[model samples]
Target: MPDPRTHLVGPAAEAEIRRLTRRSLLVGGVATAVGAGALAALRYGPDEAGIPWFLRRVLEGNERLARATFSNRLAPEFPRARAAIPRVNGRYGMAETTDSASWTITLVRPDRHDAVLTLPALYGLPRSEMITELKCVEGWSEVVAWGGVRFSDFAAKFGPAPGQFDYVALATPDGGYYVGLDAASALHPQTLLCDTLNGEPLPAEHGGPLRLVIPVKYGVKNIKQIGRIEFTRKRPADYWAERGYDWYLGL
Candidate 1:
């Protein structure tokens, strides 16, 4: 058998090895510098400067575009046959188990009048069901069947003075995870205070009893185990938004 070592001892192989080593070193150096710069900026730089500033501006730009193009276009829905069970993604606000039987959805009207609502109260209103995709910011999506009252119906009866508020805020039972939405998107016909998933009472892990299902926006905006719904003239603080994700996470 020929000696394989002899082949790799040639001038051509040596030159190729040298070229590869140089390329690898150059790539490694650039990667390290970039990683270090990002870490330093995150640790030492001011929030209004460097990467944070750029991210803020990008988020603002995205909000502007989402608003400018705002439409009541209904998100396409599929047949129930196509729906799948959604994975439980996060439990930030759901760490504490809730008492579903006694759970109530509190509405803070724009006029400052507060109303407490029950699941039966929501069911008393006309119910709507849709099989729509819940798209997560983490790059996964699931088509699931959601049944509940139309947010429009809820707003019509309980919303703050019509058009009196520009934003709506929702928080979890523990007030840990929160999301804000523009009134237009919040009252969209498809937006639902969902109570049922896949023709059954929503499972606890899936934001059971009641949750917000806004197909027009990303799943982060669809807060689970909704405890409070407030109408506000100002933009409300959001959980993911504060952590550098886009506030208006529109589809």
Candidate 2:
């Protein structure tokens, strides 16, 4: 009911006031929940890198969306002439002391005994080459030429084939960085166990000798200096996942 004396703030103005008041309350409640949940996460979550449970829920929802929406369409390829060197994403697994000559990758397959493969052995396999874009989570991208072995071919020869596993995981020798993948993406035709970049032997800065080049995922999922591979029926733990990043990390 409007008072005739308060005509200046009659129906429209009162309606606006009520709307703003409700919006303020809603915003305040959301902020309060976020703050409280963050505190709770800090006290009980995995580590300070962890976010609020509600945020995790949101990330999980995003993962679900990605799983539903993303396709296995081959990432577009460029002519080798257009390829350029990509910036080094990180060297978490590649230490200054790393000895590529002696590097060996451990493989753990669900259906077979664990095996160790020397880095040279991986390079000698039937070779594959591609010129494609590498997209980073930092909102940058580059077209690069890569030469290596197809992940599917490597798996079919040495480990479980694509459909044999529900998941795959890769890690660096020093255990500093790791990533998990769904089997589908792991065996995508564009996914490679690359050792060459832009027509040159891969430089140490770019995960030389061996690294994953998965065009279907953000660069984070294309782990560097892979020293271990696992084919599993379980969703293996991931380094960024513990730090509040989306586990799937799809493109």
Candidate 3:
């Protein structure tokens, strides 16, 4: 999990990135139209300042649009047909030495009631699988086969109807990076509490003990190292959204 204080892009950084991108693109366009020898210079300008935030945003938006246009409302696959799991990007919660034998998912309620569920308890739910595009906010996407129980099933066992809980929250054991999901997305038929990625137990880099997989959201919302899950009626604060990104970074 990433610390919101350290990993987030502040408003100032965002503004500068946007400004540089627009200037570079404008200069590049003008140079191209004039067939100027300076076109090469303009082409390399933005890269010199590091990639523009807006361009990165455009790439992410394009990915979202593409997935929305082409992805069928389908789930991932069985044990043998999963895609190769990608490298782990960060370890917020999963890095803690958890004794898998004793791990339990703690669910906090609006009334402050807390319920703890073990892995076997979670696995006992109606199982499901999904094959979907895992889109990262940083501009990459992959198709992964996931095997898990639907979140709705988990919700039902502990008592909330699929769409009844207003928010779902997850965090690493260290509480470094946390994300929140709305009820609609939480209960969406495609949302999964994944136990396997690409037919194997998730690699430590990819959030091993258990993680979330949802086609309708960017990777950030698919938090790793899930130490706790909470159901709330109010909108919960999210790690990235607090630092100036859109709260609904949905696909």
User: Candidates' TM-scores?
Assistant: 0.79, 0.77, 0.66
The number of clashing residue pairs in each candidate reads: 0, 0, 6
Superposed on all Cα atoms, the candidates' RMSDs to the truth, in angstroms, are 8.4, 5.2, 16.5
Model 3 residue 179 lDDT?
A: 92
Pairs clashing within candidate 1: none
Instruction: Using lDDT as the measure, name the better of candidate 2 and candidate 3.
Output: 2
Report the lDDT tens digits of candidate 2 across residue range 157-219: 887755779889999888899999988788888899998888787777788778899998999
lDDT of 3 at 87: 54
Winner by TM-score between candidate 3 and candidate 2: 2
Writing each residue's lDDT as its tens digit, candidate 3 over 168-231 gives 8888777888898877677767788888876777665677678888777888899876779988
Report clash pairs, candidate 2. Answer: none
Q: Give Cα-based local distance difference scores for all models.
A: 0.85, 0.84, 0.72
Sort by TM-score, best first: what order? 1, 2, 3
Model 1, 1-251: lDDT tens digits are 99654587679789878988999999999999999999788666666423367667877898898899899999999987899999988898874466777998788876866888776777568988899999988999999999988988988777777869999999986799899999889988899989899999888788887889999999889888988988889999988878767778888
